[model samples]
Target: MPGWLEVVIRSFVSLVILFTVSKIFIRKSFTQVTYFEFVCGIVIGAILALGSINLQIPIAYPIMGLLIWGFIPYFMGWLSIKSETFRNLAYGRGIPIIKDGKVLEDNMKQQRYSSDELLKQLRSKNVFQVADVEFAVLETSGDISVLLKKDYQPVTPKDMGIKVAPIKEPETVIMDGKILDEPLATIGKNRQWLEMELEKIGVAIENVYLGQVDSYGQLTVDLFDDKLKVPSPQQLPLLLANIKKCQADLEAFALQTNNPTAKAMYEKNADEMMVVLEKVEPYLKQ
Candidate 1:
């Protein structure tokens, strides 16, 4: 057999075996695939890849290694399910990163996670401050799960015993080359009314891929191949006003305290904000 042909044949067989073994042992869960499992997957793949390309290593050795590696996790998974102690030992339980609004700095140091990194994670979840989090845990997969205190959590209308407006589902008005008459009738609109709206957007009814009319009588239509990029709304005036107001407040606070560091910091930030505003004005004019 040719050398290239051997590689192709071995690669095909290795992939088939790898996928088969993976399907048997790997139970994917989106919550947290533990660090051990992730590393194991990578190592197993590397072993198979080496087995496929290297002519020196016997194919049987890699095949056996795959089985052994796969078996360990499969057995561990069973043991984890059957015993709580073993489960915790195999996949470490969540560690508290924050409790009672105070950051567990020592625990963070042990985990090698930085304060800035924690703040970034919190910000990603729409939490701007440490005081807002009641309990934050770091899962074994290196993900931060946060639970906010009741006061900080978003309050629903049901909590206040107040009724909210009924949810109105948008109905399809035009799809493909067909117009949906029933949905239009339910929203008290006809094809002629839909046509007029489509005309304003310079799109014809037959060319509309999808069209919807909401309960509020708002119409949204999409042409079959319209890919024009919409410009974002300009906000130079509002941003400039807010930045100036904040700078004034910071300067007043700095003067009252007479702290040299605070005064310098305020001056620096104010200067930077002015520079940003000046740069943004030309773009807004366009």
Candidate 2:
């Protein structure tokens, strides 16, 4: 083929290839655009532009070039997930829009998001009033996670009349074939304590998938031999009652404390209690 003709042909082929590859990766707009995907799009676009004019190379060379450009973004993304520093660098740090039930105007300015834009996202999520939000975090991907105020939240079954059992967060007994020490220390227990607790339920440490102390000071165990089971309605009431009583006691204690530390801790606990109650409402019976 003639030199000029070959170059033109390569150029046309490059255009077709670039479009096809970009469509494969970029998929949809307004979706979470990861750092890797964004970088891939740019690099592929640039390489295709280069390959179009470089007719001296074989077609195989251009195809290989496209592959390399494509995978660079994918590799970076995989790395980001494995490394916290890389993930932060790729996605950017979360910015706070609201703190302590107040809007941070300075943060909004820094993010270059106006009041209208913030309100638009909020309304899209059906959150109309700013007073309803306690803390709104602007995620790196431009998404917002809102923490709502107590009174503005939905009421739970506990609030209406249903009793709930105390269900504590399951402790990580083993992660990747290793026992976690941090949880052990937090609960003021050790390996010996865990082993004895397991024995009480006729389970071995290896046989137990997860075993932890519930908020009510009861050891809850999940055995590898058994399939998963949801708590009965009867059990839920106990858990709910435990949570409510603890919260009431905490609020009462906070009201009585004069120390700044106690006051701050109490307020923080109150906010968490409100959030939990709101989240569990759907499961509760009025």
lDDT leader: 1
Q: TM-scores for all candidates?
A: 0.56, 0.44
Off by over 4 Å in 2: 1-30, 42-57, 156-286
lDDT score of residue 195 within candidate 1: 81
Error of 1 at 83 (Å): 1.2
Which lDDT tens digits does candidate 2 get at residues 40-146? 76777777766777766687787788977766665666787799998778778899998877889999999998999899999988899898898899987788998
Local distance difference test values of all predictions, in order: 0.79, 0.73
Our tally of clashes for model 1 stands at: 0
**Model 1 clash pairs?**
none
Query: For model 2, what is the C-alpha lDDT against the true structure?
Result: 0.73
**Candidate 1: where are CA atoms >4 Å away?**
29-31, 162-286
Residue range with the least summed lDDT across 10 consecutive positions in model 2? 228-237
